[model samples]
Target: MNTADMKSRHTGGSLRTGLPSTAFMLAATAYFLLPLWWLAVAASKSAGDLTTTPSLWFSDVHLAQNLQELWTRDDHIYVRWLLNSLLYAGGGAALGTLLAAMTGYALAKYDFPGRQAAFSVILASVLVPVTALTLPVFLMMSQLDLTDTYLAVLLPSLVSPFGVYLARIYSEASVPDELLEAARLDGAGEFRIFLTVSIRLIMPGLITIFLFQFAGIWNNFFLPLIMLSDQKLYPVTLGLNLWNSQVIHDPVLRTTVITGSAVSILPLVIAFLLLQRHWRSGLAAGSLKG
Candidate 1:
């Protein structure tokens, strides 16, 4: 074919491929964003107006009133639930991420007896669905008389096999044996090397782990439901579920539930926005190593 004809054909093929990808991206973006848009619009309406108005458009602007009621109702129980979620997600993620990073690093870098067995066990744990373990966990908690406590939720949240797996993969790719040997030659203790040299290098991986664990804990419902019977101990997920059940009988609570859900998503949004950079950087580091 002539150069001009070939160029035209290549350009046409590129257009055909790119157009579908662009369209798919736009469709996916809209699909994910639609719920958020609906929540934002719904949060602004009063209970009476929420059902009557278009879900995508505002009717009565009662955002302020709804927020006021949300804050003031039941002596600000929503605030308490928010605090509980923060405690569970923040503490659990921090502890879980640290432990996962440490375990993964050890698995990736060290030689010890039963190391392969331990790693195999961890991988097995990942395959076990969390729901199946809930009853056994609850029974253990009952035996310990630890049910209805923050530890009941937070403790379990800290044991994330998936985080450990991710951290292991990241550590194998991002951390080099030469660096560890260098640190060792400099006479740094194993723990000191981990704290100063290795931890900083693997920080992006740790942050990714933390964000995953945080989101998991924040959205956790069934575990907490099975563990705690006291309403005061409820996380926002369970608390919101309770409110939703009551919304059927009390129509006024419909707006409250919608507004609460909108508000509930804020922390997750903030977390993603803050940690996305680390996640991207971690992926880049892994890719570069590969």
Candidate 2:
């Protein structure tokens, strides 16, 4: 074939190959975004408009009014729920990430007798569903008189087998044995080396772990529902769900619930956007430096 005809045929073949994948990705994106779009539209409407108006289109804008009522109703209890969510998600993620980093580092670097066994246990634990373990965790917390308190939720969140797994993977991939030996030769203690050297190199992985744990804890429903009987101690997920259930008796709460759901996701979105750069730079910092 002539060069022009060959190039035209190649381009046509490429387009044909790309079309299905592109269509699938577009479908997937729309699937995820449609709910969010509906939420935004619903949150902007007044209580009366929620049922009256089209579900995906904005009606008379009562977003500001709805937000005001949401925060002010029941003596501003929604604010309390929001704060509780922030505390639980933020504290749990930070502490969980730290513990995961430390444990993962030890598992990856240390030559302890039971290291492999311990790692195996952690990996196996990851396969066990969280729902399956929830009852046992509740029983344990009840025995300790810690159920209905923040500790019931926070303590369990801190032990993330998945986070530990990610940390260990990153530590092994990023940290070099020679670097540890060099640091030791420089008279740096193990803890100091870990804090200064290993932590910096594995920061991307840690950030990933933190974001995952944060979102998980923020969205956690069943655990908090079982653990916290007091409304004051309830996270946003449980609190919103409580409000949602009450919408049958108090239809006005439907708009409020929708508004609350829209607001609750803001933190997760902001966090991912803020740390996205670090996420993208994973392994590069360690690979270059080590």
Top-TM-score structure, candidate number: 2
Number of backbone collisions per candidate? 0, 0
Off by more than 4 A, model 2: 283-290
At residue 166, what lDDT does model 1 achieve? 79
Instruction: Give per-residue CA lDDT, model 1, range 1-290, as digits (tens).
Output: 89999999999999999999999999999999999999999999987777777989988799999999999978999999999999999999999999999999999889999999999999999999999999999999999999999999999899999888878888787779999999899999999998998888788878878988999999999999999988888999999899999977988988888899999999999999988888888767756654
Provide TM-scores for the models: 0.95, 0.96
Model 2 C-alpha lDDT per residue in residues 97-132, reported as the tens digit of each score? 999999999999999899999999999999999988
For candidate 1, the per-residue lDDT at 220 reads: 95
TM-score of 1: 0.95
Model 1 stretches with alpha carbons more than 4 Å out: 286-290
- As a TM-score, model 2 comes out at 0.96
Best by lDDT: 2
